[model samples]
Target chain A: MIEAAKTIPVVRGAFREYYFKQARAVEEPGKIEQREFGYAQFGQAGMTRHLSFNSIKELHAMLVKEVPSDVYCSNAYYKFPTQPMQEKQWLGADLIFDIDGKDLDLPCVPSHTYPVCTNCGHALPPSDEKKEYSCPSCNGKKAERVSIPCSKCIEGSKKEVRRLIEFLTTDLGMQRDNIYVYFSGNNGFHIHIGDSEYVPLDPQARSDIVGYLSGTGLLAESVGVRKGREGNMSFIKFPRGGIAYGWRGRIADKLKIDGSSIIKLKHIVDQKGGYAGFKSELDKMTREMGVRIDPQVTTDVHRIFRMPGTLNSKSGLAKTRCADLESFNPFNDACLLGGNKVNVRVKTHVKLKLKGEAFNISKESAELPAFAAVYLICKGLAEAM
Target chain B: MPVQLMTSNLSSIRMGTGDLAKYPFLNEAGEYLRESGFGWEELDRPDMKDIIDRAAERIEVGVGGNIYDKLEKYEIEILTFIVSLIMVKSIGMEPVLKKYALSEARRAEEFLTQDLKQQSEMQKHSLFAKIFEDLFKLKIEVAEDGRLFKVRVADYLARSSHFHEQEWKLINRLVQGGHVYLDADETVRLVRNELSVLIYEKVKAMTLPTLPQAIKVKAEELRAKLAPRYEYRTSAVTEYPPCVKHAIEVMSKGENLPHSARVMLATYMLAVGKPVDEIVMMFQNAPDFNEKITRYQVEHLAGMKGSRTKYSVPSCEKLRNENLCFATEECNGIINPVQFGRKRK
Candidate 1:
C-alpha cells in the first residue's frame, strides 16, 4: 500500500523556502480571521483544522514554517462579543466571484476523477466500486480527490478570464479600478471585487448578480420591442418609451436599435424559426459569459482566501497579480523563483503552454525553468532530482 | 377620468417626520409582514436625517459603510420612495445623494414584483389585485388551488355596471399571466419594463407627500410631474375606471399579478368566449406558466374538458373581499355582472 505521508517530501522542502521568504498578510487580519477562522492543507492530506491566529504575523509565521500546499481563509467575518468563531455570530463577508478552469469545456481536453487507494496505491474507476474497488491491492480506504491539474485546459481558462472581465465591466458596471484579476496559481482565475460598494451585498443580491451574468433566467422580450414592418419584417426599439436605467438600460444595450442586429433580436420575440441561429449565438455567449464562480465564496462573509503572494503547491506558482492584465502572461510574470533550470523526469506527455511557447513534453529527463519544473512536479506529472 | 396629479402645490405637501405606516407602501405588505411577526410595524423611520447627514458627513470626512444593513424589506421600499422624493426636490445633493438611494430604488422595485408573485404563495399579501377585479366587476370562477377559470362578466352586469367585457378581459388576462397590464390615457406601442415603475406611479399619482421642511431644500430640483415613474405603453382611446386603469398600467409593464387576481382574470376571459388555447397562450410569459397544466385548466373552464360543467363568475360580494369593489354608476342591487343590465320586472 502506498500510504504517502501527509507532507510531500521534496516539494515541501522547496515550497518552505518560497512561502516563508515572503509576507502576504491582509489588513485587519486579527478582526476578520479571528472571527471567521481559516484552514491549511499540507502536502497531499487535507486541511489541518479550522484555526484562527492572533495577528497577521502569526498567520505569516505558520505559512513560512509549514509551507502547506494550499491555504484558505473564511469569506465571512465572525462576531466575538462573548463567544468564539465556532459559535453562531457571523457578521457577513465581502462579495467575491471565482471562475475555475474545470468548469469550462476545453476542446479535446480529457479529465479524470478517480480515487487512489491508501493501502496499495491502486486507483480505480469510482463507478466500478462494488467490484474491484475493494482495494484489490491491500484493503485500503477509499480515494479522495487528488485534484490533479489538467494542463491542456489552460487555453480555455484564459478565455474564461476575458468573458468574466467583460461581464463585470460592461454589464455589471463594476469599476475597473476596483476590480482585481489574479491568476489563481493553478488552473483558473480569481476576481476580487473589493471595497465598500459591494461589502453589504447579501447572499440574495449576490445570487441575483450571478444569475444575471450566467444567463440563467433571461427573457428576450424584456430586452427589446420588435416594431412591425411590411410582411413580417420587424426591428427592435427601446422599450416603447425612453429606456429606464439599470436593468432596462442593460437589456436595451444588448438588443440594440441597429438594423442588422434587430433581426437577430426579433427571431425569438416573433416565434420565428430563425431563433436557432440566435440560439447558437446565445450558446456561444453562454460559454463565454458562463462564470463558474464558487457560490460559497461570494455568499459567506467570513471566508479566507489564499494570500496573494503565497506559492500554491498545486502548480508551484504564487497566486500572482495581473499587473498589466492586457499583456500579463502567467508563465514569465508569475515566475517568482530563480530562472535557473532544474532536471525533471516527467511521467506523462504533458502539453504545456508557457513562456509564450508550446512544449510537447513526454516522459523524459528535461531541464525547465525552476518554476516550470516545480509546476510539473506539483501537478503529479514529474519527479524532481 | 384619469387623475391629473398637480405639482404646482409643493408648499401644500405634508412635511412631518413620519413612519412607513402612512405610505404608499406598508399597506401593500399585507399578511406577509404580519406573519413574519418581527415587530416591523413598530419601527419608525430609522432616522432618514441621520442617514443623509451621515452620508454627507462621510463624504466630507471619508467614511465607508452601507446603511442598507439597518433596514428590513418594507422599510427599504419606503426609503426608496423617500429618496426618490429627495431626488425630485433637490439638485445640489444629487451628486452625493446617490449610492444607497439608487440601490434602494432598485431593491424596492425588486420587492414589489416579488411581493405580487408571492401573494398566494405566502399566507398574506396585499388585496390590490382583488381590488382591481371588483372595480372592473369581472366574474371569475376560482378553483381550489386558487386557479381562475370561466372568467366573464354577465351581459347584464357588463351593461349595468358599464364594465367593458373586452377591455376588462384584456386587463384580467394580463393579471392572470402575472403581469400588470393597464390601458391608460397615454399613447405608445408597448412598454417593456418591470413592476418598480408601478410603485412610483401609483404612489406619485395618488399620494404625493410634501417633503419634510428640513429635507425640502435638497429636493427642490425635481418638479412634481418629472419624478421617476415606471415606463408604460398607452395606444388606447377607451374610458376605464381609474382603479381598473391602474391594473392595466401594471400589466402593460409585464409585472406579475397576485394569485387571487389571476382567478378573477381567468374566469373573466372564459365568460368572454376567448379560445381556451389562446387564453393559455396569453400566459406564456408568466414565470410559472406550464403549457400542459395551463391548457388542461383552460380547456376545463371552457367546458371542453374536465367535468364539462361550465363554471360561473364570482359574485360582487366575493369580489368585494378581494378589494375589487370600486363601485360607480354601476352599483345597484346587482350581485353579479349578469344583474347589471337586467331591469326589475
Candidate 2:
C-alpha cells in the first residue's frame, strides 16, 4: 500500500508547480470581497474556512502560497465574509445547481466504476443499485471506489446539463447568457447563475426552484386527469380553453399524438388500458423529463463551491468553465498541469486519455507525464517512484 | 356626473373606506387613520367606548375560531381592528398575539377570495395583486377569465415551502413562462400564512400604552383566559424515539410544527401514558397554539371523543413518508419507532 507520508509530498509537489505558474489564471468571482473562501491543504483533515480576500491579487497570492489540495468560494454573498456563520449577515446568494453523473443512475456507471476493498484490495462486482460499503470478503468498513473518466459518463452528464439549461431558459425564463456552466473536473457539471434575478433568492426560494426541476410531489389530478365517478373509472379532462401551460402541456406534447380534444385524449387513455395505465405512462415521461440535480447543494446558501479554473485534486484537472458546452471536453480542456515526465508505480490496470494522449497501462510500473501520474495518484491507484 | 363616466373613474381608483374597513390591515386604512388625525390617546376617551368594546369582542371571537360580526360603520370597523392590535399588545401574551393575527388574516382571506372573483377587467390593481406585491414583492398577473392568478414560480416556491400538502407542489400546478397558475381559492389560501406572519410581526412590534379602565379590564380578562393552566413539564424520558424528541424540541422553541409531526408527538405521548391535559400543555408554546383546539384534538386522539378509537403512534415508515423521522444510530433496526429501545428495556 502507498503510505500517506510518501504520497503527500509527491501530490503536493505536483500541485505546487501548477499553482505557482498558473494561479493568477483562476477566474475572479464577482464582488470577491463579499465571498467566503475555503481551502484544504495536502493530507489535511478538514477545511480552513471563513476566509475572505479583498482582490484577485490577494486570492492568487494565497493560492500560490498554500498550494491547497482544493479551493472553494461561497455561492452566498455576505456582509462580513470572514465572520462566523450566524454573524455573516447574508445579503444574497447565487443560484447554483450541481449535476453529478453518479446521481444520474446511468447504465454505464457500473461497468466503468467498481468498489474495491481498501483493506485487502478485493474488487467487488459493481451494480447500479446502492452499494453497501462493507467488504463481503474481509468485512472491512472502507471501500476504494474508482470511477474511470469515460466518454459515456461525460456525455450522460452533458445531456443533463443541456436539459437543465433548457429548463432554466425556456421554463424558468432565465437569461441564457447569465447562466454559467463548468466542468466539475470529475464526473459532473456545475451551473452558476450570477448577477441575475435568482441571486437574491433565499434557501426556501431556492428549494422551490429545485422542486420545479425535480418535479417531486406531483399529483396527477392537478395535471388534467381525474375520476369519472363510475365508482372506479377514471378519465382525462382538460380546462375549457384546453391544457396549454406547464407540466400539463408538457405531458400533452409527450403523448406524440395529434388533436388534444377531450374525446381523442380520453380514447387514447382507454387504449392504453385505463386511468392507471395512462398514469404510469405520464409518470414514466416525467421521470425522463425531470431535471436531476443534487438538492442539498442548491438549497445551501452558505456552501463554498469549488471555484472555477482552480485545480480539482480529485482528478488533477481544473474546474474549467464551458463557454461552448457542445465542444468542451474535460479530459482535453481541463488538463492544466504540465506534461513533464514522472516515474510512478502502477497499482492496477489503468486506462485514461489526457491532452489527446491515451495511456493503456497494465505494467507493474511505468514512467508517465505529471498530469497522468497526478491523476492516478490522486485516485489512489499508484504511488511515487 | 354621468353614469358611464362614474363607472370609468371607479375602475382606475384605489380602494375606498368600505374596502379598507374590510381589510383594516391595509396600508390605506392606516393612512386614513393618520390623515384623520386619530391619536392613540383618543383610545382612552369615553367617546371611543364602542371601538374598544368591539376590539375586545374581536379577540374574544377571534380566539374562539371566529372574528366578531362586521360593524355597520366603516370608521368603527377600521378603529376596531386597530384597537384589537393595541389590546393584544397590552396583554403582552405571545400566544394571544399569534391567535389574533391568524384570525385577522383568515378574515382578510375570505374577503380577498370574494373580491378576486368579483373584480372587473378595468380595475388596474385588484386587492389580490396589491397584497401579493406589497407583502411578498411577488410579481403577479390574473387570467382574463378571473378564474386563475399567475405568480412567479420563485415567489410561489418561497411561500409554499411550509405547505405540506401534495396539491400545493409546483409540479402539480399549471406553470407557464416561469409562473404558476392558481385558482381563486388556492391563491387566497397562499396569502393566509404570510398574512398571518405579517400581522404577527406588526402586533409584536407595537409598544403597550397606559390604557383606560374599560380597555385595561378587557386585557386582564383575556390574559386570564389565554394563560397556561399548568407549569411546563419537560419530558425527561430519553427512551422516546428520535422523531418525538425532535418534534418536542421544535415545539419548545415556539416554531410551527407540521401537521404530521403534531400527530406523531401527540400519539407517542399518549402511548407513553401521559395524560391528555399534560400533552395539551406541551403544545402551548406552538406559535399558533389555541387551548380549546389543542385540548379537543388531544382528547380525540386519546379515544375519549366521538370515534372512541385511539390512534396508535405512526410507524417509522409512515414518519419517513411524512419526512418527520430523525432517526439515529441508537434507533436500532426497529421497523416502528415504538420498537426503538425496546430490546434494551
Candidate 3:
C-alpha cells in the first residue's frame, strides 16, 4: 500500500497600509484628518492580514491544538467575520473606433502634457472665460477650436471634443456646462463627472457594471444575437459543445464542409470593414448558398488607472501643453478610464489558404474576407484596422 | 443404463470431511455430507468408524438403486429443458414454455415403472427406503397403485421464487469479478458495489419532486451563508493592517490567549518558538503593536504546542498545521499506515 506524503505548512507575507490625509473644508475652520485602513474583506489582499501572528511559533501551536489530522496546512488562511465593501468609484470605459478615422491630437499641459500633432500644435489660451479657436490649417471650416488641450493636431482634436460633448450631454445625462471633458493626452477621451453622488459605489455594484458590459452577468443570458433576415449569415462559427478539434473536424466533414471552409468564413468575417459591410456580404452569401448567418459583435470594457502625465497640478484644470515629445505612440500611451464610451478600435487579421491558393486579407474585404474580419473582432483575438 | 445411473449418482454425491478422508478413490465416493452439528468427541467410540463406513456404503447403493437413478435422470432432463427456457428468455426471446404440452409423457411413465421395480429389488435384500430416507432426508413414495412416483422431504426448505432473479444477478457480478468461487472479501466488495448501484438507481427513479427541491434549496441557503465565511485573508499581520495589532496582542497573551487568540498565538509560537519575554519584547518594540502580556496568556498559547493539543485548536490554521504534521511523517497514522515496504526502488 502506498501512503500519502505529509503536507508541510506554508507561510505567506502579510502587510497593509492605512491612509491618513488632511483635506481642507470650506465650511469648517480647520482641516480634518481622514484615516482608513486600505484592506478590504474577502479578497486575497485583505484576508492575508487576518492570518498574520506575531511569530510563526504561535501559528504552529494553534495548528497543533485545533487542526484536524487530515487537513493540510497550506489550505488555511485568515478568515474575516464581515464581507468587504467593494471599491466602486474607479470605473472603466472604452473609446472604440467604429470606423477608421484620422488620428486626432488633444491638448495637454506641461508636466501632465502629452504629444500634440506637429502639424497644428496649438495650446488653449488660459482664461476663466470659455472661448473657441478655429484651426487655421483646416481653414476654420473643418476644425472647430475648443479650450482644451489637443495632443493630436488642432484640426483633428475637434472630433474628440465633439464626442465628449455629445457623451456628456446625451449618453451620461450630464449638463454640457457642468461636465469637464479633457484630452487624456493620448488616443482616447476622458470625462470627469464631479458629481459627488457618483463617487463611491460599492465594489459589487461597480463589478456589476463591468460584468454587464463584459457579458458575464445574469442579464447576459438574454442578450443574444438578434435574428435578422433569413439570408443573413455570420462568418464566425463557434463550437456546438466541448468536442475536441479533431472531433469537430470530423463532424464538419460529416456536415459536408471542410475545416478550411470554416476557417475561410471566419477570415472573411474578421476582414469585413464595418458591421454593415459584414452583414451585406453575409446576406449575399446566404442568398446564394441557402445558408443563414447570424453575426454577433460584443464589446468588452476593461478597467484601467490613469497614469501620470504632463499636466501641471497648480492649474486645477485641464490645459493644452506638450509632454513626452521625444517618444510618443498613441497605441501604447492612450489608456481609457472608467465609464461608457463607444466605437473602440480593434484589429483583426487572419491568413486563409484554399485549394493550393493563399490570400491575405485585412478588414477591407467585402465577401468571405469581411466575415473573417468580424469573426476575429468578436473573439477578441484581433482588431479591425 | 445401470452404469450411467451409477456414475450420475456418484457425481451428484457431495463428500463430507469424514467420508472424504476415508475412501481410497475419494472422487468416486457415492455418499456425501454437509457439516453436521456433531462434535469430534461423539465419534471417538471404537465402533464409530465401522458405523460411519457402513452408512456411506448403504447411501452409495441406495442412490445407485434403479428407481432412484431413473427418477434422477428424468429430473435432470426436465431441469435442462427448464434452464434452456430461462436462457432463451434472458436473450430477449419471448418464452412459450408455459403454453407447451408435456412432450415426454412416455418417458415419465417408464421412470415410474423403473422406480417400482427398484423398490421391490431393495425390499428383497434387507435394505429398505427407511435407511436411505434417514440419511438423505428424501422420501420415496409410490402413488396410485405404483402408476405414479413422488419424492418429497419433510424438513427441506424450497428456495423462494425470486431466488433465481437474485442468483442470476449475483452470478453476473461474480462473472465480472473473473471468478467462479468468490472469497468472503471479494463477495463483500461485490455486495457493496451492487448495493451502491441499487441505491443510485432507486434514488434516480424516485418521482417525488419535493425531495430533491428541498435538498437543493437547503444547499443554496447554506452556500450563501458559508460563501462569505469561506472568503479568507492570507496571513493576518502581512495582509491586513488592522490584523497586525490584533495578532501582536494575541501573541502577547502566549498560552493564556483566548480560544481564538490561542490559535493565533500557537501559530506564531510554532513559527519562531520565541520565549515569553522575547515575544512580549517583540510586540512592544513593533510599531502600532498593542498586546499586554500575562502569565495566563502564555499558558493558553502553550496548550496548542504539542501534537495532541493541535487537534483541539479550532482555527483553520491549526487544521492545516496538523495536516503538515501528518505529511511530514510520510502520512503514517493510526488509520492508514504505509504497507508493503516497497520503498522507492
Prediction-by-prediction clash tally: 52, 0, 127
Choose the strongest candidate by TM-score.
2
Q: What's the best-to-worst order under lDDT?
A: 2, 1, 3
Model 1 residue B239 CA deviation in Å: 46
> Taking the tens digit of each residue's C-alpha lDDT, what string does model 1 give over B46-90?
556653443233222211223332333444444444444344324
True contacts kept of each: 0.00, 0.57, 0.00
Q: How do the residues B128-204 of candidate 2 rate in per-residue lDDT, one tens digit apiece?
A: 57656666676678765566778877777777765656567666777767777787778888879888988898887
lDDT score for candidate 1 against the true structure: 0.48
**lDDT on C-alpha atoms for all candidate structures:** 0.48, 0.78, 0.27
- Per-residue lDDT over B1-345 for candidate 3, one digit per residue giving the tens place of the 0 to 100 score: 111112343433333332222211122222221122333343334544433333222222222331112222322323222222222222221111111111122222233233334645544211212322432333444432332223311011111111212121211111111112222222122222222233223323434322223223333443343345335444322221122245565545552233344344434443334566664454443333456543335544555333223222222212221221112222222111111112222
Whose lDDT is greatest here?
2
* Model 1 TM-score, all chains together: 0.46
Q: DockQ for each candidate?
A: 0.02, 0.31, 0.01
Candidate 3 C-alpha lDDT tens digits along A64-91: 3432111111111113211221222123
Tell me the deviation in Å of residue A196 in model 2.
3.2
* Top DockQ model: 2
Cand. 2 TM to true fold: 0.78
Give the Cα error of residue B64 in candidate 1, in Å. Answer: 44
What are the chain B TM-scores of all models? Answer: 0.27, 0.63, 0.17
